[model samples]
Target: MNKPVPPHAPLLEYYEAPAKRSDFVRNLFNRTAESYDGINAAFALGSGPWYRRRALRQAGLAPGARTLDVAIGTGLVAREAAAILGGTRDLVGLDLSEGMLAVARRQLGLTLVQARAEALPFADASFDFVSMGYALRHVADLSALFGEFRRVLRPGGRVLVLEIARPEGRLAHALLRGYMGAVVPALSRLSGRESATLMRYYWDTIEACVPPAEIIARLGEAGLAQVGCATELGMMRAYSARCPG
Candidate 1:
């Protein structure tokens, strides 16, 4: 059997065992759900909305497309997608944390489901687009996640996955690490104690995440076609692929 494509190596500092990771992440997000959007806004410097919209549009999100926003924390990516689709009528949001889903329900009028990325509850060929934002590092297996993405997408459907990669330049890496590790967490204290911890854990995951090449390859291996990646500001990566007809 093939080994699982974990987004990051075991984060033993936060969870004692690999099997405990799902519970650890779910609980952490639940605790910080209320403050999640604010912390993201602070870290992204108010450019997240524009950036997400642009990425979605560039990846072929259009009006009338049925979209699924997996791991849709607080409706960040889903909101942008809804705008492009003209409304939330055609969009669905799914996440593992009910706390985050609560916040999303208040922010968006779409259907929300509490579910895991590896095991979507939807039927095959149900969506024209699939999106995941900033939560790739928290998944248990990229292969399983991508397979589900491919399964739920109709022919010619597009999948867009947004992630933050560690910068390749030494100076850039250090600067980003300093900002995310020290500065962001410090500012996040105003949100809550859990918010601060979440920010710190966020940076740790990015630093330890599997490389973009591995991610792209896994998407292709999952029977997706035209898999490619686009980067912005040297750190933000938008991975796009198409479901084969």
Candidate 2:
């Protein structure tokens, strides 16, 4: 049975799905492109960049490796990975959002491509590392996206996906819900940025998203090996998987 579509998926809520998701997400990020990094920092309690760096390190990024950062909004993860990999590696950013990529270009001058994760415009076995940062819930199909990750990865390549998971304990869950659902939006509004809607959507999507076990199963189904998750503070999760030769 197909999983019922989550209510707060920006794509399903604002537009018809599967076809309109790409456009809706692209436009949504475009609308918040300039302030994305700031919004992320605010929402994640100023640890967003640190989390990206830690995730890349945990994913075993090597020096001089070819990396493709999918949904590389404003180059958040890509920037951290590049800096960690000595800032001279061949790194590129891909996304459906021109506005976001434009900000990334201005920020880092990376090779940015406007494309969808479900249909990556790259050759097979092209990259040693593939990373997507905090955009998993926005995808139309996790299976298809993970399959693309495997297709574009060379043998022995790794994939890292960072996402915000709902907290486990009742107190933690309540705090997380209040923080993301109310505090972040209030902060966004106070800051005079139009990202309050996006913040609310993020919290709802994170809370309604599939569990980590299902994500790991999909990674295996996509032919990825050594699938695992490193969860932090009972809320943030980094999924690490590898392509077998």
Candidate 3:
């Protein structure tokens, strides 16, 4: 059985801790889908799309590789991947929110299916690359989700994940917290309720998330090899690992 969202941490537990965590997260994303990319762009200071593009390049994603992007909200990562692929037809996107997938469809015109990460519907050894961007915190069970990644990806397939991390060092950390906890939400007040709520949730999740070391260890446990990580400005994290041949 899939694990329930861990209750050990108050901040990470989630705001809508009702029903299954997956359902609540899905509903939240669906409700926020229309404004999702805009909110991301705001906090990313208009560099969200560019960051995704560069991060995908760093992840070594190449054109013509069969790719599956899990929890690909609004195709943020898929769009970058599509740019490298010359078209979107070769990439498949999976997400739990139809609302988000609808936006993704409009954005990229790629194949998309509504599905959870822990219980992927694809057959084993089906993909050359699998990526999940900015949605690891929303998953109820990291192990199950990564296991699904291992199962679906063909041998030698690579996995990439991009997420914002709590900054290291006292001053940078404090500044980031101020931006996420204060400035972002304050700015969101002008943006809309969806943006504000999403920004708050962003703070909570980033603050209470598992540390980068532990995430790397979990990736190892989930059967990925040669695991490695990179951080930008001590906040943006990029994780890469590969399925063993």
User: Which candidate has the highest lDDT of all?
Assistant: 1
Q: What's the ranking of the predictions by lDDT, best on top? A: 1, 2, 3
lDDT of 3 by residue, 1-245 (tens): 65543312544355545445667677778888888877776677333768877877777788878999999899888888898778886799999999999999898888899888889999999988888888888877778878899999899998998877787799988988898888988787676876687788878788888888878887898899989998877888889999999
Locate the minimum summed-lDDT window of 10 residues in model 3: 4-13
Candidate 1 per-residue lDDT, tens place, 62-178, comes to 999999999998999999998899999999999999999999999999999999999999999999999999999999999999999999999999999999999999999999999
What TM-score does candidate 2 reach? 0.91
Alpha-carbon shift of residue 169 in model 1 (angstroms): 0.5
**What lDDT would candidate 2 get against the real structure?**
0.83
- Score each candidate by Cα lDDT: 0.94, 0.83, 0.82
- Candidate achieving higher TM-score, 1 or 2: 1
Q: Which one wins by lDDT: 1 or 2?
A: 1
Q: Which stretches of candidate 2 lie over 4 Å from their true place?
A: 1-13, 16-19, 191-193
**Among these predicted structures, which one has the highest TM-score?**
1
How does model 1 score by TM-score?
0.98
